[model samples]
Target: MLMTGGEGRMARIHCKITPLSVYLVVLAMYSTLMMLACLENEELNRVAREQKQKTAAPLQDDMAIVRDRRSQHGKWLRTVDDFFKRMGTLETTCSKMVSLGGTYCRRALDNNKVVCLDEDVTLKSTNCTVYSFGIGADTTFDDQMSHYGCDVFMFDPTVNQETIVSTNLKNERFHLLGLDIFRYNRTHMNEYPDGKKENVTGEFDTYDNIRRRLGHESRHVHYLKMDIENTEWRVLPNLVEGGRLEGVRQLAIEIHTMDIITAPAHQVLPLLRQYWQVLERLTRLGFLRAWYRPNLVLETLYYVPGENRTIATCFEVLYLRRGPVY
Candidate 1:
């Protein structure tokens, strides 16, 4: 059982080599497992990036569609704004502009109704005639015209009075008729002050028919004032077509754009186009705009598209005939 010294030394060397060989095998196995883990992580990262690209493609397409629609809408709004500017521009100047009805009756500091008249041509005779429409309780303009020896005929369908009432001014020259100026000769149902809707029989007529009835067909209207709500857009074309405005020297009208301002976004352009056409017709009939004032007392504001500010929906515009048409 006893070993020699050389054999004992060889056995001790074998034991030391066996432990070092086991340590090297364990280290190699750990390195292989780490390499497999790194390959699995790289595959997962690639899948996530591909999934993100797939998700973002549809969203980018949707954003492009929205931007294109916005650009088209902006272009439509700009066209409407240009038409509005043309309607408001003044074509001529009034040298002797006088604001009739000096007292403000409608919550305004100044009167929006103005008359342009030259001393030599307008209101110079006792036979001068004035027709005032839409007289709502305020007769300052009618009364002042009567004082100038002008035959003042005021018309209002909403007034609480008989068919025709004569006022005590300048030898009873002011005649207030409960009639309406319409586009046709027909009965119009108007709401009175008592909130009753009555068919105003034989009370509405076209400007030409009314002129014939009043025996003013051959005479000149020195001053014609109209504030007939939104009816001007309807009645004015008939007047121009029938040559009713030939004898009118001065016209003071209040234009209303409430229908356009209150319409839907899609309908605003069509309504404004109709309004512009009416203005163009007036211009062709030799009626030039002398002055224009936005009625601030109404406080009806319209937000013009593609603009940062608002504009008044109502305007008091005065038009004068260029020369003697008759």
Candidate 2:
């Protein structure tokens, strides 16, 4: 049974993986494990930071008063506002305002002390929707809404990143889009008698197009601000009639109302009637307030036979869709 040296070696031999190969496997596992750990930690930190900032915003504003123009007056008015504001309650007094005429706005406060509004000092917080259309015109509404926790989608087609970015609004909640909503048309025109004749540069888009570009999957639009001039008469009805009305909470439109004297004799009354019908319809739907604000003095510009260009005044209409968050 004694074996040769080759046979004895074959029976007793053992094999092991090389140390370098083992080291390589361990190194790959360690690298992968470290990467996954780092990724999870990074995600956790990001979420934590977002939550902290969002929660901290209110605490900061509460400590210090924002040094705004009417702050002192607002403070004084707030004292008076609190007493009477609670007394009347919007639900009860809003009906009175409709019939009380110019004096009713004053009725909200003292017996006779109506709010003297130079720049629309309505003093009350709007729970309804506003569709603001003009750009250069100061949007006190946007400022007021942002001060509160309500989401505001401000559209400034002027297209400046700085103005939109450096907003006091929270980056996540506030969305600003630079798009012009228009009726289906090849050419668009703006006519302002008091303001400059500026041509809009961006490609016109539809309402659906705008919602997609913004990438906000929000089903109901709380405040739809439209500064889109004459095109509103054409585009707005579609939104109201096409089940899109349910999405809008408030719509403030700087409506371009051409002067009856300036418009063609046949078209003036009909145009007025068209707007009246729209307002009546909205009111019938519980949008009880149709406010006219002369925010700007605009000139009209049109092609008038031989003149080649015509101009008229652009006015503002704040269409308040009543009821809280529909």
Candidate 3:
């Protein structure tokens, strides 16, 4: 009985020892896996930090470049504003003159034949030189100025031969020419056949070329009128660059496509660019806006389609050379 009791005790001890050893082995394996996992996590974090550091320099550089470009553009706009501050101030002019044939044919020509003032009435008698571009079938403006003893040169490409033939019946002081003002000579008209060309001769000439051709190199233009459709944009710039405005006393220009008035000046668009360029050139030439009349005849180019609110598509501006208001 004693030996059997001893054997039972040994069996119980063996059973308890086997389970405890298995539990210890499982616990040590779990601990090893946890340590490996912790090491791998730390290594991954280190690699991520290294990658971010590698890309940080270039990212900062790109940010800096963007900032620099913005700064440069801002500076450019500031310079333009500074230059515009030096332009001529507004000056008022007197009564509306008579329109020849069209309702939009009138502008103040000033009092004197040489230097004009805002309050001065049109000269009643003077041998001043008046250059009128874009004469569309009506010579009333020229005739009136001619009656004032002014030598008016009227140019238009569409004037009929019969009209030129009847010039004697028209203003005797007016010289009508079948020419159109262009940035270049119309020699290219020869490329097309006579009947195919839109212009009678397709022989458009610049203002400077006309002055040289017409023997007015030294003579000053007392009054200059331009209503050449949308060609005024190109023609006016050419005249400015050629120093033609130096001798022009009073200028009446029909600036087209002014409906972009709603646009902000800093917008990177073509209209604002042209607008600034025109203003700068005119200001540099000592030209001041004396009067402005909105043109209701033309359609707005920039506004919404068919929205008839009168957006100033085409307008007449009378400019007087900046001087005393005699």
Candidate 4:
């Protein structure tokens, strides 16, 4: 048969191509494409992992990164919310309770302690007892509470022996203890000694030891008031942990802000923790904030120049135990 050069070339190609050969060519191409795709996917995954490691948090010891993320001011604001939620909810608890003394002795409520009475409580005012943690020579509340028939036990290391001997003049019902209530048992030197000595040795007492020493092991406290100048933070948590607050019906505490009282940029980690510990323990112990009064006076200012707009960094909060008092 006569054929052109193009026809002859086509006939040769057709002769060389068999079905098995065509299938082998297709299989080779597919295998090559799969190998390329696998390599590309592996490279992409390695790049992704490297980027993730680079963006991760710094690698360091757990102790170095331990910190409190909550702000002191934010926690203080939350106390206001807690107060409203707990106030006037307990029928047995006094609703007419008030701050007896001046601004310093303010609590959540402001009714006179002497005249104020709640008949629904298990312990009556006549038979109840009050434990006052700190008294800076102020006996207004103590005097009122005494007159109303409650025995008041006051403890303050700062009070001198002369003042202690003059108990009859202050209030016969008020029993002043020389020991101070602190989270730990430590000795503190008195700033002003009777004979002009700068450092007189005084001991700080713990809650458990105080109970044992005073023979109040099984007693129930009708009221408890604290103004211990930042000591409340640690002391409250200790009380909560030791189950020492099981019998306390009412608690009036003064919370001081570390921002104003603490030294500038000093060992502030411990001070900041006090706030969190107290807040958490209060929630766990079934205690509710019944009242909160902020003291805006005596704001910290510069020695020479300052602004009066700044408010004080202390607040008086009253908490009521919700559960049964045993």
Worst 10 residues of 1 by lDDT: 54-63
Top lDDT model: 1
Model 3 stretches astray by more than 4 angstroms: 1-124, 165-199, 258-269, 298-302, 305-310, 323-326
Q: Write the per-residue lDDT of candidate 3 for residues 106-205, one digit (tens) a residue.
A: 3633211122332233433455788888665566666656666777787765554455555433443334343345443332221232554434433466
Question: Where is model 2 more than 4 Å wrong at Cα?
Answer: 1-133, 137-140, 170-200, 259-261, 295-315, 322-326
lDDT of 3 at 155: 79
Assess candidate 2 and give its lDDT. 0.44
> What ordering of candidates by lDDT runs from best to worst?
1, 3, 4, 2
Minimum summed lDDT over a 10-residue window in model 4 is located at 58-67
Query: In candidate 2, how many clashes are counted?
Result: 34
* CA lDDT, every model vs. true structure: 0.65, 0.44, 0.55, 0.55
lDDT of 1 by residue, 1-326 (tens): 33347556523223346877899999999999999999999999999766644321223343343345334543433455565565566655555777766466455644436766654335664578888887765667777777777788877655545433544444333333332444324455667668978765434566766677778778877778888888888777776786677677778888888786778989977787677666656756656676777766445778777888777778888877662121
State residue 262's C-alpha deviation in candidate 3, in Å. Answer: 16
Q: What is the lDDT of residue 88 in candidate 2?
A: 22
Error of 3 at 274 (Å): 1.2
TM-score of each: 0.63, 0.44, 0.54, 0.55
